[model samples]
Target chain A: MSSVLRFRDLTLGYDRHPAVHHLAGEIERGALLAVCGPNGAGKSTLLKGIAGVLRPIGGRIERMGCEPRQIAYLPQAADIDRSFPISVFDMVAMGHWRSMGLFGGLGQARKLKVFDAIAAVGLTGFEDRSIGTLSGGQMQRMLFARLLLQDAPVILLDEPFTAIDARTMADLVDIVKRWHGENRTVIAVLHDFEMVREHFPQTLLLAREKVAWGDTRETLSAENLLRARRIVEAFDREALECTRAA
Target chain B: MYDYLIAPFSEFEFMRRALVGSIALSLAGAPVGVFLMLRRMSLTGDAMAHAILPGAAIGYLLAGLSLGAMTAGGLIAGVLVALAAGAVARFTALREDASLAAFYLISLALGVTIVSLRGSNVDLLHLLFGSVLALDEATLLLLAVISTATLVIFAALYRPLVLETLDPGYLASVSGAGAPTQLVFLCLVVLNLVGGFHALGTLMAVGLMMLPAASARLWAEDVTAAIAIAMGMGVVASYAGLVLSYHAGVPSGPVIILVCGAFYILSLFFGRASGLIRLFSGRQHLEA
Candidate 1:
């Protein structure tokens, strides 16, 4: 079957260096594709390119049978602070940005969907609380609330489980599994091998270049992993330490 | 007690205008100021505050103290400078703060030079010190108009502005988000700076924006609540500043800034978020 998202010889980068080059991959419908590599392997950049936050420099990125607005993207929550002055309701309500029309206000039905999404993430009674007051896990749950509202068939996440609670991580994986069961394509940029082994069967191995793409066990070989580790652009001792501890 | 309450209300028109004008600006500036603090754009506010000096000089040259001419001239110059800064940031290698500081500082230096060359006998105190007792009807009306328009627009565009401020990639439109929208917004920043330059003057006009908002942040967990608290602090301080200036016979501008300073200082000790009071109180109180 034709995949949901197809990247054909995709080349992308900042001005000087090549971050992701000569990447060719297809994400099958209902498959959980975990992109694994070391730090600075351009996993985040690739997700950003696919999410429309960044544009590709070469080749093709096709969203077949999909519109740009329908593709749900969970960007790295780097700029967002836990101390920001916002409510969980306001945060999840952002998912309805497109449906709100030009004025950016949600309809009554969409509003209900927001509540449903929050409940799905098991964060009931959190709608009115300040986002700043939440733990990292709760914050991730709130983001999932927004994601549920999008209800897109294709979901792209850039390191969603970083610095969050174990329970939230399990919930997130289960939610991803649920999405796959529903025939939705899920592409996630992940650093943790254990997470991929337990949750995702399909894997896409990348390190600024496409190393390998196949079944999780096949692509996550020691040799391929060593190559990915060697080629990864940044030295994330912190992430490695966390992985070891986990 | 009677004097404290009734004197301000029954005072001279300039006092009434000063009281009203400062309150309007404090309310308008407080909300925007809170966002600026969140985005770390308070430095931009400082830069822009100083940057408007040349525009004020230009205004002085054209109107010789005509509020309309001065406001128009100052706003025109402010918009142009902000537009230039925006364009430079988009097109050049220079970062936002570096470019803004350079442009604003250079303009301020140019202002001093021009004022020295063209102005009569060059009394810098009027520009720096401020005289709230000199506000006329026209200036008061202008303050009212700016206040109303600003508050209304802020209410309408609050969410998008917050989102855009937090993350540019996710939601920002590619089409520059238009000049008029930006022009009006930046002009508000500029108008508050330039308009208050006479009554409260340049430095404090900028300083008070950050101080009250920053203090309010310590007390509030939500943007709306923070904004409300900030406005309350700003208004009360504005009145206190004017009264203090009246009693002490010191300059109004610095006194007003000093009042905001009080709030920030007090906030450091008593604020809900990072307060010394909370730190001590929590330790003393038993917990599970």
Candidate 2:
């Protein structure tokens, strides 16, 4: 299969301190890949780098055959503002932003699509409810509905299943599988190894850098997981900037 | 009741002028205030109100209290201060609120100093507290034009503005509209403040913007409804405050703000959404 995303010695960080450092790999089109790592191992940072929300401190990420907007990104739930007064239907309608654009109206067809997506996520009765009143699982389902409307060639989900119930997680995993079946590239940052091993075909294990990559089972081996934990524990708090050249 | 409530506006030209001017300010400023509160920038909006004073004061200094000059000066000053504060927050260790607070405090002091240099305490008080009853035809037209422009721009920018407020990071990842939407929103805030200061003064202009918005937030569940409620509250408060002030022989600006304050207090206690009464009512939970 052709490569969709290539990380060429990419480094992502805040305040010149690299959170994700010196790793190189390619994500093939239609690949279901999980980025697994310990806390502070920069899974979210890497996802942010790919989403173009955060700039790389070193090297670059190359996207092939798609514009930036053609990639759908769902950040961690904590990044969302639950208190903002927006209804579920309107929030879900934002997925059509790619097609309808800034000034375009939500016509009959688009409204139907929004409703269909909401129904797909099993949020039919909750359409008019304010997003602030939604439980955690319902919020995730709503976000997934928006992702359905996005209909992008590539999708990046950051910690999508955290704080979610089992039923909701299963439903969302099915949606991710559905995207993969449709030949869309899906990259997710996940902590649950059991889910990753069972569902994901490929995995990139990181501990501020790559530990292992390729087949999910092999990448998430006990030795590699232990090594990742050690590497994170050994990370220097006051280390100077990396002298290594990309 | 007619004589006490309606006669002052119907019989006196100045009272009518004050009512009309405040209504325009309410219509424009309330929606902007709703967005500001949503973005949690109510304090920033208040700071921006004060930031306009130095500009208006300089205009008064140069042109001797010309409406056009003061309005233009306030707009420029407010925009500059906003840009400077934003830049400082982005580039330096200082936060946006701290930077904004610093800029506004300096602006307020400079404005008072500038006004006092040429004009007496009476002129300073007029600029600070506003003289709504004395609005000229030009000022009234300015308020009308501002209200019209604000409504049109709001209608056009509504979608992106809501997305930007609700999910800025998501909006950034999806489109390039985030920066421009934020910039336009800031300009709207400054524009409304400039328009408001013409009648409500710099000190009290933010009252017309924020109090009604806060009161509406307690009552409305959705943003559009909140904005509509806030706008209605502002207009009502303006009309009521004008008549009350006329009868009480008091200043119109402070009375208008006081009326808005009263609405906020009443909403705090009795509004349907998230009010004290609802919390204390102790209704049992519905079955799932």
Q: What share of the true interface contacts does candidate 1 keep?
A: 0.25
DockQ each candidate and list the results: 0.25, 0.68
Question: Quick one: best lDDT, which candidate?
Answer: 2
List the candidate 1 regions with Cα displacement exceeding 4 Å. A38-40, A101-112, A125-129, A163-165, A221-246, B1-4, B80-104, B121-123, B167-187, B247-250, B282-288
> Residue A205: error of model 1 in Å?
2.2
- The docking quality of candidate 1, as DockQ, is 0.25
Candidate 2 lDDT at B131 equals: 90
Candidate 2 residue spans exceeding 4 A from truth: A237-246
| TM-scores for chain A over all candidates | 0.88, 0.96
lDDT of 1 at B195: 62
lDDT of 1 by residue, B144-189 (tens): 7777877888887676666666544445322234344445567667
